[model samples]
Every structure is written in structure tokens, then in C-alpha cells.
Target: MATTTISTTNIIQMTVNDNDYNSHFEGNLLDISADPEAYYRVVLFGYITPIFFLITLAANILIVLVLSRPTMRSPTNLVLLSMAVADLLTLIFPVPWYFYMYTLGYYKFLLYPALSCNLYHVMSEILPTFFHTASIWCTLLLACQRYVYICHPTLAKVWCTNQRVTRTILAIFLLASVHQLLRIMPTIMDDNSIIMNTNNESMINNEPQKACRQVIAKWTTSIENLYFGTYFVFRIVFVHIGPCFLLVIFNVLLYNALKRAEKTRNKLLNKQQSTEQRNGSSGWNKQQQQQQQSDDHQQQRKANRGRDANSTTVMLIVVVTVFLIVEIPLAVATAIHVTENMFTVDIVSDRFLSMTIIFSNFFIIISYPLNFAIYCGMSRAFRETFQQMFLKNLFTIRLTARSSSLNPFISTATTTSTTTNTTTTTTTLSSSNTATATTLTRMKNISSASSKGHY
Candidate 1:
């Protein structure tokens, strides 16, 4: 979630009262401000939001691991891998910062003054925005790649190469970094100087005075106006709105292409079945039969690849859809807040805006972890690969160990039974060997006849 930094100059001008800062720091979006309801809401969010972040962190980690596997690597999966990495970074710094900020309150500055203030502004705000921007663009790239692959197959071969995808992802990260730097440049952290309390001369003379401080983070007014007035509008249009619009267009094209592909596959399947029935009655020769079987096998493999690709495309569409559902409201709210100056308005408007931002943030965080579930639910290859990576090998090891432990008992039982029926076993083995040899000779003669027929 993006946040506008509020000036703290007024807060700094206020006299030190009760040895504490009088106002919230800059970039502090959730202003509870003694409101019982807002405070409780924040407390609730502080406690519950971490759980969501943890889940998102874990899920994105799994996504990275699975997509990084050699067997799973593809242009599409590589793009997804980049997204998972971005999501992972999105939560890594912010979760702890959020926990400290909300649960412990803004007094963190008093304890670790400069560290807390700088980290709060940078980690909790800027870093997440940077990575999230990358993630959004990555989703857009996935949609575009799928659209081209499904709608224009010939072009997909040239455009969707793994190297090109990697370069595109890098370019996205670079652009996001540059954008973040522009947003960060206007905002600066104030020197949090520790001050000694000297209210009482007697206390000052007797012992070391107690220390108090306030950390300020604010933007230069000129630069701030320039950014919020112009570049911010550009950001909303291109970064948030443009990608979403293009994703919708691509998704529609992909869905139509999917329908067409399905129709074509059905037609081909029916044709193949009719041809097989005709050949069955006509008695095809060995060479012709072998050639037909080879062609069918190749066709089946091609069809399976196509099906897997289509399934992945559908899964990506759902991911992009969910992203839009969660993001559009936030984008609209942000645009309103920016245009109407919602934060600087009346108390009721400010409170409503804060709540809107918080809830929108909640939904956005929830959306990050959902891609894992979508991949598991929709893509057969993803499920199979996940099972192979996490489930199958573990089970195979246990089963193998269990079978090994029972092997001695089974071997002993077999030896005793063999000892009791030694003569009968020998006679049976001899007859079996003779039958196998006769069968092998008959198969050899048939193979020779088939080879001669081919020649």
C-alpha cells in the first residue's frame, strides 16, 4: 500500500510535554489519535496482520522454491519466480517494522531513535512499494506472455524466450527502483537529538538528567508539491491503472484463444478416432501400423504440452483477476485521497480515509499469498511438482525403510518353503525356462517376418 507522508514540522514546533512527542511521525498512515474505535482497529490489525504476512511469506517462499527447480523452469515459471521473490521481500522487512510500530507504538523512536524512524519510513513504506510495483508489473508480463502464446503462437516463439523474460523482469526491477528513489528523494529524516531534562536544578545538580527525543521525517515543500502534483498522477496512471487495463484486455484475448484451441483439439481428436476405426477394419500392415502408432504418440505428446500450457494460462488469468479485484479499490481510493486532499480535510474525513487505507491494505496483503493456492488448485503440473518435491520423496523413504526392515523375515520364510519343496521347485523352474525359450523363439520369428515386410 502506498502512503503520502504528512509534514511533522508542526509536531516539532510543539513544546515537549510530559517528555514525549506531541504528534505522529511522518509516513505514519494509521492515525489512531485517541479515537477508541481506531485504536482498537489498529490493535486488532497489529495482532492479526502478522499472521497474514507470515503466511504470505511462507507461500511465496514455496513458490520460489518450486519454480526454481530445474524441472519447473520455463519462461512463464521464471517470471513467476521473480514475482515470488518480490512478494517475499515485500513482507520481509515490513512485518517486523509493523509489529514494532503497531504493537509497541511510536515510542520506538525513544528507544532507538534514528534507526526506528529511518526503518519505519524506508522499510515499512518505500521498500514494500518498490517490490509491490515490481510484482504488479510481473503479473502484467505474465498476462502478456500468455496472451501472445495463446493468441499468436508464431510470435510467442520469438518473444517469450527465457532470456527475454529474465531481461524484462530485470528491467521492471530497475524501473521500480528508480521510481522509489524519486519518491524517497523528497522525504528526509530529521536528526533525532537526545535532550536532557533540566526542569529542576536540584535534580540536575545531584544526578544525570533523563533524556528525551523526537524524530521527524518530512518532505521539502517544493519537491513534495511537485511530486504529489505531477509525478504522482503519472504514477497512478501508468503504474497502477495502465497495467490493470492491459491485463483485462489480454485476459479476454486469452480466454477467446483458449476456447478456439479447445474446439480445434476436439475436432482433431474426433478425426483421429475415425481414422483409427477405418484402419482397424482395413487390416493395416506391420510397417504402416508402426508408422501410425509413432505419429499418434507424437501427436498425443504435443496435445499434452498444449493442455498444460493452456492450464497455466488459465491459472495466470485467475491470478491477474484477483490482483485487479484487490488493487482497483485501493487505486481509486488513493486517487480520491490525492485529488480531494482527504488527509488534510476534516476529522471525520480523515478518520474515514485512514480506515479505507487500512482495509485496502489488509486486502492487498491477503492477495499476495493467494497465488500459491491458485497454482495448486488449477495447475496439474504445479501440484505434481509440489508433491514430488515435498511429499513423494518423504513417503518413498519411509516405505523403503519399512520394506527393508521386513525383508529378512520374508527371506527366511521363502528359504524354509524352498527347502521343503526343493524337488518340486526344480521341476517347475525347468518347465518355466523351457516355456520362456519357446516363447522367445516364436517372438523372434514374428519380429523377423515384420522386418522382412518393412524391407
Candidate 2:
């Protein structure tokens, strides 16, 4: 390998370096030496991936916490919660292993039966991919539901009931789980070969050896490649490109419909207001004015809801795009490796490129905790609920646990002490009304002070 310095702008260029052609085994060497810049790129990714994972975990936990409250449940929120759960998984699982090995120096976390490695591999890879795909797909469903409700109000009134939405969400979860589960099989057992653990040490010339190596040969590689390639193509076609295009189209339609609805509502409200002003004190004018105000209120609410939906849709799109952009290269690279003699240098570059993707896994883990932040950013109601729960924790909690000293005798003793002190210091100037006023003021101050103390 030859060494060179690279700028931030050329990092992606480095990944797609098209200069050399070599076989997978011969083509590229993993080197921080060849391109010191590549090392920095990997290191930079290492730093960001963990941070993103933490953010994601915190955010998703917050979402779950907020939604778990009984009062917080709603049809839309239920869907949001599901998406958050999926996003949380995306951010939580795989990155921890990377972080553990790279940062914490704790590899060999999977020390179970060698079979467990295959299981862990399947689970570690499949679950996150499935959940993320579900999250993206769910966003599209939610957007479509909102669109129906907003644009075709009459049809929505009939078809978009809470029950229907719940069923749809359940279906999505089940389907996504199944779809993603299909990909998991490749990691477990490729073709007719099971990834078995064997302590079988070969004896060379009747001499036993302690050292043994796990073998995955060319036949297995070909089989694994076929499985990965099929899923890779499926994911690119259905999960990545399909959902992205659908979301883009859905959001565009949603935006137009919302705008048109706002215009119509404003027009009606204005017309009604003009009718009221011209009619001048008739019963009809009063009725029209009231109706216009009501219309304005409803329009404001619709506009707010539209804005929330749009924001959520956009954030979901960001999550999906980020996942795809980071992950696709690895799949493509691996798939290309299947065809032994294709572009050799590109394959080596792909192998090196695959490292960047592997390092990027932490970003997704960090995103798991972040699903709540996305919701908070996108939805006013969610933010309001979050604030009410955490920001106003004192007010939100209902407890009457006053201090032990706040009893009747304690209050009387304090009052008596104050009165005695006042008697010694003052010239008998207090009337009954004044005394009553003074006591009430003292009590008010004490209550206010107590409330402050409680908080």
C-alpha cells in the first residue's frame, strides 16, 4: 500500500478510489499507515458514533418514559411510540459491542458456544435492520393516515378510526419483524453448512496441536454471498429506495393539501367576518361572527397538526437516510466481493470502505436514544407532555406531605411565641381586626414558604 494525505472533502473519494484492481484477498490492506487521513476518518467516526448512540438512547428512553404515562396515550402517539422503540433498538444494540471493543478494550463479549456467535451475529444484525426498516415504513403509514384525515375529511371520518390505526400498526410490526428475520438466517447457517464449534485439533504426523482456527471456506463464502446479495438487493429496492421515495411523495402531497386547506379555511373565516361587519347588529351577524371565530380556532389547530406531522415525517426521513447512507456501502462491498475477479482495486477499496461503515455503527446506536428528541422536535403535543412531566416535576406530582412541624400545636406555639415577642416590643396598638389581619398574613406567608420548600 502507498501512503497519502487526504482532506475532509476527499474522504468519500477515498472510499470510492477507482485506481486499482485486485482480488479480495490480494487487493487492499487495512492501513492507518497508507493514508493517515483514513485513520483520522475512522477515529473521527469512532468519536461521533458513540456520542450519537448516547443521544439516541437518552432520547428514546425519554420518549418511552413520556408515552408510558396513562394520560399520554393516543392513536398517533401510539404510532410515535412504536417508531421510537424501533429507533431505540437501532441505536442501542450493535454499537455497544463496537464501543466495548474499541474504547473499553472488552472484546469476547460473546463467549458462549461457538453457535452462540452465529446467533448473536444474526440477532445483532437482523434486529436493528428490521426495527429501522419498520420505523421508516411506520412513518409512511402515519403520514398517509394524517393525509387522509386532513385532505379527505369525509373518507377519514369513516375509515381512519383509532381501531383501524391500531391494527395497521400491529400489522407493520409483524411484517417488518418477518421481513427482517429473513435476513438473519444467512448469518446463522449458510447453505447446508452450520457454523459449528469444534475443539477438533488436527494432528500433523501423529503430533497433537493446541491451536485451532475457525474456518469459513470458499463454498461457504459463496453461499453467504448469495444470501447477502439477495437481501442486499431486496433492501435497496424495498427498504431504502422505496420508503424514501414514498416518504418524499407523501410529504409533498401532505404539504400541498395542508396549504390548500389553510387557504380555504381562512377564506371562509374572512367571508363570514365580512358578512358580520356588513349586516350590523342583526342576530345573523352575531351568529356569523361566532362561527368565524370557531372556524379560525379549528383552522389554527389544523395548521398546528399539519406542522407537527410534517416535522415528524421529515425527522423519520433523516433517520432512514442516515442509516442507509452508512450501511449500504458495506452490503455493496460484500456483494461485490462475491464475484471473484471483478474490479480488484475497487474491492480492496470496498474492504477499506467497509471499515468506515462498520465504525459508523455507533451512530445508529446513539440514535436509539434520540428517537424522543426527534419527536419532541417534530411534535408540539409531545414537547408539552415532556415538559409537563419533567420541567414541572414539582407541580406535576400530587402530594400533600407537609412538614411534621406544620401541625396545629406547632403552628399555635409559633404564633404564641411571635405574639409574646410582639407584646414585649410593641405598645398595645393592635385591634382584633388588626390581630386577625396580622395572623392571616402570617399564615399566608407560612403557606407560601411551605409550598416553596415542598417544591
Task: Report lDDT per candidate.
Answer: 0.73, 0.57
- Per-residue lDDT of candidate 2, residues 1-455 (tens digit): 22222221121112112232212211111112123344443454445667776766677788888977778776666777777887777656756544554455333121234454444455456777777778867776766766676667798776777677778888888888888766554332211111213221222233322211122333445575566566666766676666656666766776677577668767866986776576566556567768867876886787667566556545645544554555455445444554433333444565565555555444444445545556677667678888888878765453323543356477778999999989964544454467777887899999999999999
Model 1, 55-154: lDDT tens digits are 9878988898898988988999999899889988887878886677566664222323345556667888899999989998998999988888887889
TM-scores of the candidates are 0.73, 0.60
How many clashes show up per model?
0, 17
| Over 4 Å off, model 1 | 1-37, 40-44, 105-112, 191-224, 277-291, 342-348, 400-455
lDDT of 2 at 99: 58
As a whole number from 0 to 100, the lDDT of residue 2 in candidate 1 is 16
Q: Which residue window of length 10 is worst by lDDT in model 2?
A: 24-33
Q: What's the true lDDT of residue 266 in model 1?
A: 97
